[model samples]
Target chain A: MIDSQKPASAQDAEHHRTKMQKRKAVQDKEVASKTVEKGLLIVNTGAGKGKSTAAFGLALRMLGYGRRVVVIQFIKGAWHTGERKALERFEDLVEWHALGEGFTWETQDKARDIAACQGAWRVAQQALANPDVGLVILDELNIALRYDYLPMEQVLADIAARPESQHVAVTGRNAKEAMLEAADLVTEMTLVKHHFKAGVKAQEGIEF
Target chain B: MIDSQKPASAQDAEHHRTKMQKRKAVQDKEVASKTVEKGLLIVNTGAGKGKSTAAFGLALRMLGYGRRVVVIQFIKGAWHTGERKALERFEDLVEWHALGEGFTWETQDKARDIAACQGAWRVAQQALANPDVGLVILDELNIALRYDYLPMEQVLADIAARPESQHVAVTGRNAKEAMLEAADLVTEMTLVKHHFKAGVKAQEGIEF
Candidate 1:
């Protein structure tokens, strides 16, 4: 019985050592792989104001990190005080595509509106497929989908198939059910009050 | 002379009418488009501690919106914590890939680390290429790039080639020069004081 006990004790000791060594190795490995790769998607929806503004703030944060970013403005084809000037500062780092035709009803030309949308969508598709892009913002795209100019299924499919580490953001009002369903993050900007309702026009830099 | 004046006045009236019509059209199309397309990249990087936390906050927001969000945690894959637990509630919308193999000296396996990084990058690439994915967050991509595990050039090129409206984000310590140059908006989070330096361990919910 003494001899049996001795062997059992020795075996237990060896097992413990092995477990310790394995754990240590795992810990060591973890330490070795200290780097990480992750991406984010932000959606600012609802009828509130500042959705785009908030998204832009996040974009600025990413940009400060020296990361690559892209912005696609949907219904906002006209020149705006904020993006028009701020985006240009990035120059090579930023690529802006304006949907020159504006909204659907403004032109009263369905063909022209669709063509402009297609043109803008082409750029968006390219940005989505590119892995180097750190951030891509779809400013005011939600309304485009609501107007039936852009296909929702195609958009959702593209997002699902993008690089896992890439980050994406969509800002606008009335976010569709599918978009909300497909998104990893959604923010609804509820409007409590607005200066526009009080007869104040959109101010430069502040509103645009 | 009288006839000439009459013609000039008529032409001026016609010009005024056309200008007014154009202005009215522009005003009528002020409704913002609401559409969310796939292929977005968001980056959260700086000297601050809340980059990842903020990114996760967005992920939670998206989950609440019923969207699926995949988080590939680099350099931080370890025991489960508060963020992990809270995200687990929406298992379908959230996924965590822990690649925190610890610091470089710990593993002493450069080849293995590279391979693992490539594997993780492949997943990221797939996510970026997907259209159905509304948001993709690269948790700590900056660290990987800083360490040179992920090819910076390839990353940049991929970003340049992505779809037009897709959104994306990247977060980490120090962003690369190339990344900042390509980003549309850049924001730097200056570090003030961190609690960790004060001998405080990570807290639940707040730090996790």
Candidate 2:
């Protein structure tokens, strides 16, 4: 009765179960094989939104684990953002810094721009050196490197010299090839479509 | 003397300032032209990480404004995650639900998977229908839709029927073309490089 009276759905279900059991075993083996652990340099770059936002998400996660999280914005000015307000609630574990005046065009002063980048980099270097800080986010550091405001070679060296167990997340568009090579993980946020193109203004609590 | 005695760097700086001033004028005008404001149908999809992480980031932003943010995970099981722990801190403004047992392969049971999707959809429907839910995140709903666990037409209809000012963020890979067409913003997280490829295990407070 169990075999002869089985419905089509039951047969299909049994087939699926068998296939899945085999797949799960292979996946479990593969997962178990991965045993290395070290600090990771994560890069979030591309033309789409959420590079910094995703970094902030990682900050939240790191903070959740009762670790120190430092965010240093390189190109974005000290704008009022919802993430800032929310993250500041975890004041004990969060160190927030908005070091730039805005984008390069917004700042316009080449000397001042370079000076700001240098200042931000100093702060970033300190965070990177700190073994106690679980995650250090150099927000929009790529733009500074792209504009030659900071030496890419020195930045990469500083990242390499960071604490072995401290993760760093760098977010921006046009991440330097050298930076990408140095990164353990890189995610390019591709812009499939944008609401700003559709004349949707950046709203509070959403765009920020 | 003002022009002839000027240093090369100063002259270059002046040129850059003039160029930037003109550019800023155009940008300001364009920004001012965007007057329309409404809820955004945002989609985060692709073959990379952070699709769900970015959604949680948005949830955090929404919660900053004392607004309600509901996250309904459709494909992910009730796994212990750092984002869940941190977001739960804002108990009054957040509603978290992890309805699926795991991925399709992990579950294997077609009937059970479909039932889980339906249950998740019901929860999502309630949040989407409510105007007070500033942002409703349909996490991994694309995977459920990709597998035909839920009717795409009905899902889209419910999203469209939501209140005018209720924002919705749908996250997963391989989002439907129809959904893309209906979305105000769509970001595809492209995997350039992944740490997992290097046999780096998913560490707590990082991958989770």
Candidate 3:
């Protein structure tokens, strides 16, 4: 018998082998069915803090591939962030625009906010038109849209008009339903726990 | 007379200014209350992609600060992913260990899988002991736990036993409830759309 001299652990191994062989067959078949490829409109939105952080990470990944990426910060324009500083090393591949005047509340000037947004939008439009830019990250664009700083219709139109193979990543919380519907991929970052609630100040490299 | 000089857009701008001023005052006060500082246990989990991607991005940020970082990938050992190759460029500042036999189904040998995990665990424990490593990323550790490749209690205890100032990032899906309860920050990646369903094969750099 197969078990005549086999130890208990060996028998267990034999069972596992048979089980996994079946699983591999199933997974391989499933993976083989997928074949479509195209540029994606990726959205990062929710209550969690990493939406922008994740987008910047995607920006760095694209740069690692020798591709061009542009980051259009829709908020915190006046604040210098760690991602921006770190990406400087990849200057040839990364074009960053921390162009917001500030958050609308921080600036406290609606007219000025509108002017700044319009200017940023113009720059974004230019980046979208460029064929060489592989990815366009509209950082915190959701916050701008939430406050009605920019017209949603205009924003959607611009995104729609971008090059076919140009990937776009939009980040911020409370993304409009329309934005979600328009996206090819959307990730809602759900906050399970936050250190900020425990009076932990945002760390420099980690938080920024 | 007022309308003669001020257009409707100007009137809207004035309204926005007042609203934002009040918001700014409230936010500034709320932000001032947070002041504590301590290391955190960060968890990235869920069915969607980017749990590991976001964690790696976080690791890069830590490395940017000239801090040492280590990544212990507990699954997909046979797969030489693009991220691994890209990260190798930061060899001086980063240590990566892809120590799995393969995925559970592919390996189909529970004993061998357990041995690989235990080996990775030893490396992880050693890294956790080193005070110089700022961040320790236990990539795919959850999958091993899910499959009973390692004891959950041992994993949790080891994490709890890390250096007081050391930050740990655990990535995978179906994280144990106890792990989430112990974490300082947790983000669940909720997938709204995946191109994989559209038959898109994993592309290098982007998928890896």
Using TM-score as the measure, the top candidate is 2
Tell me the lDDT of model 2 at B176: 95
Pick by lDDT: which candidate is best?
2
Say which candidate scores most in DockQ.
2
Candidate 3 per-residue lDDT over residues B108-142, each given as its tens digit: 87878889999999999998888888899998888
For candidate 2, the per-residue lDDT at B145 reads 92
Candidate 2 global TM-score = 0.96
Per-residue lDDT for A1-208 in model 2, tens only? 2466789789878987888889989989989989989889999999998888888888878877888999898998754388888886788988988898887788789899999999999999999989999999999999999989999999999999999889999999999999999999999999999988888898877887
TM-score of chain B of each: 0.72, 0.95, 0.91
Give the deviation of candidate 3 from the true structure as CA RMSD: 3.0
Clashing pairs in 2: none
Q: Between prediction 1 and prediction 2, which has the larger DockQ?
A: 2
DockQ of each: 0.03, 0.70, 0.56
RMSD of each: 19.7, 2.2, 3.0
Regions more than 4 Å wrong, model 3: A1-8, A78-80, B1-14, B78-80
Stretches of candidate 1 exceeding 4 Å from the true structure: A1-37, B1-208
TM-score of each: 0.44, 0.96, 0.90
Q: How do the residues B1-208 of candidate 1 rate in per-residue lDDT, one tens digit apiece?
A: 1345567757654554566468666675543221222333445455654466555545544543455566666555552355565454456756677765654434545555566677777787776676665556676778778878899998877666665544455677698888766654333433433333333333322233
Lowest-scoring 10 consecutive residues by lDDT in candidate 1 chain B?
B31-40
Candidates arranged by TM-score, highest first: 2, 3, 1
